[model samples]
Target chain A: MRIVVLAGGIGGARFLRGLRQAAPDADITVIGNTGDDIHLFGLKVCPDLDTVMYTLGGGINEEQGWGRADETFHLKEELAAYGVGPEWFGLGDRDFATHIVRTQMITAGFPLSAVTEALCDRWKPGVRLLPMTDDRVETHVAVELGGERKVVHFQEYWVRLRASVPAEAVVPVGAEQAKPAPGVLEALAEADVILFPPSNPVVSVGTILAVPGIREAIADAGVPVVGLSPIVGDAPVRGMADKVLAAVGVESTATAVAEHYGSGLLDGWLVDTVDTDSVTRVKAAGILCRAVPLMMTDLDATAQMAREALTLAEEVRQA
Target chain B: MRIVVLAGGIGGARFLRGLRQAAPDADITVIGNTGDDIHLFGLKVCPDLDTVMYTLGGGINEEQGWGRADETFHLKEELAAYGVGPEWFGLGDRDFATHIVRTQMITAGFPLSAVTEALCDRWKPGVRLLPMTDDRVETHVAVELGGERKVVHFQEYWVRLRASVPAEAVVPVGAEQAKPAPGVLEALAEADVILFPPSNPVVSVGTILAVPGIREAIADAGVPVVGLSPIVGDAPVRGMADKVLAAVGVESTATAVAEHYGSGLLDGWLVDTVDTDSVTRVKAAGILCRAVPLMMTDLDATAQMAREALTLAEEVRQA
Candidate 1:
């Protein structure tokens, strides 16, 4: 089966690792969110893309779920010695070469899609990783600090501040006019099943959908569009998903997440067994809903979740 | 007293360490050659500038004499795993950060001189280090590979090829139109004495003079432009200096180097004791000449040579 997954960083990388185990023979194409991309120290760093690449390519730090394992901070110290560090985020020295190569290729007249393809040539993550768009579509969050509104990049809000404050608004800066990258719509159209892994709905899938023509292409893909709930028991599985979801006015609940994505794009929605009671409200809202074990504790558990998502997709296709 | 020195990589770095000890109170300015500068894995790497920075900042590896003292290679290994094994040149993980910051700052509307200043802010190298120019003046070498004229970047020729193959021509690509970076001329003009360290005459010092107005400023300084010989008894002090000088039509001799710079720029010249016989020959060319222990074997020895150069400068000033 050809499965297409739209993903964000840590959660997305972990889920894709599981998906690879679940369907080894299934051709997986991941449309990764580049909204969190930051140009740091003169290199283009796509956190989500790198996470997926490293996780699947077997270079990821399993504990940190980001950066390469056995990474060193030589570059960071050198940068610090040069007084060039805003060193909140853990940008390991080993991880920097990837960003540097990507940036170099991009600067040398290649679009990010081409540069990403060139980078993937070495990693060969067994899945085609396509960034949502080649253009710059940064995700920014507005917050009130000292009774004044201030906007910061997604990485600053996520990594540096650790998202401590409440966000007034979340904006994907260039998403309104940003066109989908070349392979995005084709992957969606040719996909047997499109899955939204337990990634941030607001930032991951929402950011992808916000890009012009991508959501419409998925909606008309004529394949089952299944979304697994990132929230269960009124809490996010991991990360600041709940905090960001709150900014977008979505309660950390399965039914609310479903209602937020709404009946427009989702064909099948997977809720955790803990949120089994909320399935009716989701189904009643004109969407096919299934309750399943969604915790990706290990590869087997995540594959099981992947199977559940695919099974729900089959059911929606039949209906 | 104001003093200027032309520099290269490790050997030059070590020599500068001695020069620092010798001229602790002199206002020293380094005319660092960027000919060996290369874009590696997408980062702008200036080997000589870094050598000067690390050495003067007390971060230089005493043993390696190039990178940080206690450096890690985790990033380099990772880059190798990605099959980017340009394994000839040593780019330690700690060192990559400097290049990244420099490249980043340079891309973000800052000239390399300003970036170098910003970088030196933390290193506090004490001596002023200036790049030859802000312009991209890449040095290329024409080599006969299988009887075909192939032009390769200086680093590839020097590091990868190790200058084993014969070089037909060495060209500094943009030097014809490149202006001296800000402060370069003023440093040359205000110098009480300018001493050329035991660096490669062709690639290192030659590239510095290639910048449009620098040679004239040094000639016009009117105090004295004295040089310590990189060549002692026909062989270079270190590296592939002899081969590169031969490529530029200069013989690997103390007299030939002084003759190469010629009567036009230099006022006084110092040769190794081994080349004492050539002092009279060098004097005939209108440059004040002296035979001394020009080889900087240790700090005390180098300090003696530096003092000798100053004494010669005074004698030349009287003449």
Candidate 2:
């Protein structure tokens, strides 16, 4: 089977690891969200793309589910000592090599998609990874800080501020003008199944979908489009997904999230067994719904979740 | 006393440390060579300037005479793993931080002179370090590689090739069009004594003098311009200075090096005790010459060399 996954950072990367294990024979193409990409110390940093690359390639910090294992923060410490900072973003020495390479390639006139492919050559992440759009698309969050409204880079909002203040708006700046990167539409068009792996709907998967033609291509791909909920029992299983979801006025519930994606783009939806009650409401909204164990507690548990999503996709195709 | 020094990498940095100790209360301004600067992994690596900064600030590796004392190569190893390299250059993690900061500032439109000053804020390297020129001035070495005469970067010749082949020509590529960096000429004009450290006469001090107005400024400054010879006993005290010195048709001897600077710019010259026989030969060329212990074996010994250079400057002033 040819599977296409729209991935974010930790959660999506972890889920993809499971997907890889569950469907070992399947060809997977990952469309990674570049909206979270930030230039730190004049190097391009694609958090989501690196997360997926590192996790799948066995370089990831398994405990944190992001960054490289056995990584040192000497580079970051030195940069801070030089008073160059966004000190909150934890970029390690090993992790910095990725950004340096990517930045060098990009500065040399290679598109981000080409740079991603080159980086993946080292990781051999198994799946082909393509950034959603090569053109810059940064996710910015509008928030009220010190009683004043300001728009901050998504990283500052998420990593630095820890999403402390309420997000008034979440904007994927430049998405409207960005064209889907090469091979993106073709991958979606030829995919047997498309999966959204419990990533932040507002800024992760949502940001990728915001790219001009990507959402339209997936909707028109004629494949079983299934999504696993990031929410379980009215709360995010990981990360502050609810905060950004609130910015888009989506309730922090599995059924609400499924309805937010809506029946037009989603053919199947998976909620955790904890939210089994929400299945009927999601099905009532004209999408096939199933309640399965959605927590990626370990590789096996996550693999089982991936298998469940595939099974649900088969059911949607048959329906 | 206001002292100005022309510096290169390791040798120049070590000599500056001695100078600092020798004249503890002297106002020192160092015009650092930038021709050895190169862009590696898309970051500006200013070897000479950084060497001076790290050496004086107590961050230098005492044994190697360059780079950070407790440096790690994790970033470099990772970069090599990605096959992104001219893998021979030894840039450590902490050293990489300086380049990254500099590259970022330069990208944001800061000139190298300003960037060097900002970097000094962290190192507190005592002297005011100014690059010879803000404009790009790369030293290119013409050599017969694989039996073909080709031009390669100065770093490639010195670091990668280790100056294995004879240097047919040493060209400071952009120097003819490059103007001295801000304050370079002013520093010379106000200098009480200008000293040339025992840096490479061909690439280090010579490259700095190649900047359009700097040599003229020093000569017209009318202050005592005294130089300590890098060559001793008909050979360079350190580094492969002979290879490049030959490219300019100057023999690698204390007398020849003094003649290379000439009496017009150099008022006094210091050679090692072993090269005492060359003092009369240098004096015949119309520049005052002296024989002193020129080895920088330790701090105290090196400080004595600095004191000797200052004493020669006083003698030249009296003459």
Candidate 3:
């Protein structure tokens, strides 16, 4: 089976691990969000991309669900000691090897997508991983701080501020002009099923869809396109999905998120069993909706969610 | 008093430490060689400049005579793990900080000389440290490996090969076209006395003089210019200085080194007491020569050598 997954960070990585378990022989192509990419201490850091790579490649910090396992922060600590900062974003020593290789390749003039492919050669992530766009796309949050409105990088808003203040606007700075990286459209065209992991609809998957032609491609792919809810019972399963969702004036409810993505690009939606009441409302908004136990408590539990999403894809395609 | 010193790695750093103690009130400016500077993992590694800074600043590994004390190789280990190398070069985690700061500042468009000044701000290495040139000048040594004559980076020859083979030629790649860094000529022009520490005659002091106007500046400055012999009893006091000197056709002897710098550029030369027999030979070459106890056993022993150099400067100034 040829499956294309549009992914974000920790949650997406966990879901992919589940998907790999559920479909071991499947040919998976991942389109990773680069909106969270930031340059720290002069090294390029793609949090979402690295999270997926590490998790899928068996190097992930299982407890945190991001970064490398057995990682040390001595590199980051040294950077801090030099007073070179954004000390808030943790980059461990083992994880830093990823960024160093990546930055070295990028600085040598290879496009980021090419660099991603080259790095994947080492990780053997069991999937062809490509960045959403080689061009830079930083998600900025327009927020009110100390009664003054300011725009901060997504990481600053998320990691530094912990999204404490309401984000007045969630902006994907370079999306409109970005072209889908090579193989993206072809993968979409060849995909049998496309899944959006329970990643943040506002900044993770939404920021990617904000890129021109990508959303159009998925909408036109004629494949079963299904998404699992990042929000369950009016709360994000992981991360600060609500704060940025609120930036776009979307409510934290699962139904509202389905309405935000709308029926144009989505074939089906999966909400958690805890939000069973919202299934009918989400279906009423035109997405073929189902309620599944969505808590990724373990490998088997997460694999069950992946299996359920694929089952929904089958039902939507048959209908 | 104003003092200008030409320096290389460990020996120069140790001598500078002694010079600091010997003339506590004197204003000292160190012209550090950059031919040994290299780009490893896309970060600039300035060995000579950093060694001087670290040794004088109390950050140097005492026994190893380079790198940082209490250093970890996690960063280097991680780099090796990625298979991105020159695995031969040892860059410890703490020392990586200096490069990160330097590369960051240089990438932000600061010249190497300015970057050195900023780094010195952190180290507070007593002497004003200046790179020989802001422009890149890598020392490449021509050698025969498996009957193939090829030029390799000096680090490759010294670190990887361990200088085990004969170096056919020693070339400073960028020195011919290089301009002395800002304040280099000014430092030379305003100097009351200049000393060449027991540094590599080929790569260190020689590379510094290779910059366009510096050798002329020293020659025309007309102040007493004294040099301490790097060789003790026909061998370098430390390091593989002898190996590179042979590549340049200079015999590895204290008298030959004095003759290599020659009477035009050197007014006084200090050899170790063991090379006392060669003092007349150096004097016959028209440079005033002294045989002093040159082993830098400790700070006090090194300070005495520094004092001897100053005393020689006074004698030469009178003559």
Q: Write the per-residue lDDT of candidate 1 for residues B56-93, one digit (tens) a residue.
A: 88889977667778888877776776677687778888
> What TM-score does chain B of candidate 3 reach?
0.99
Tell me what fraction of the real C-alpha contacts between chains A and B each candidate also makes.
Answer: 0.89, 0.85, 0.53
* Displacement of the residue B102 alpha carbon in candidate 3, Å: 1.6
Can you write out model 3's per-residue Cα lDDT over A1-319, one digit (the tens) per residue?
9999999999989999999999999999999999999988788999999999988888899998888787767767767766778789988877777788899999999999999988887888998898999999999989999999999999999989999999999899999889999999999999999999999998999988988999989999999999999998899988889888887889999889889988998989999889999988888888999999999999999999999999999999999
Interface RMSD for candidates 1 onward, in order: 1.6, 0.7, 1.6
Best by DockQ: 2
Better of 1 and 2 by TM-score: 2
Clashes of 3: 1
The Cα error of candidate 1 at residue B150, in Å, is 2.6
Q: What would the per-residue lDDT of candidate 3 be over residues B84-188, giving only the tens digit for each residue?
A: 887889998778878888999999999999999988887899999999999989999999999999999998998899999999999999999999999999999
**Residues A61-110, candidate 2, lDDT per residue (tens digit)?**
99988889998999889999999988899999889899999988898899
Error of 1 at A266 (Å): 2.3
TM-score of chain B of each: 0.96, 0.99, 0.99
Q: Which window of ten consecutive residues has the lowest lDDT sum in model 2 chain A?
A: A36-45
Clashing pairs in 3: A72-A93
lDDT of each: 0.86, 0.94, 0.92
Candidate that would win on lDDT:
2
**Residue B288 displacement in candidate 1 (angstroms):** 3.7
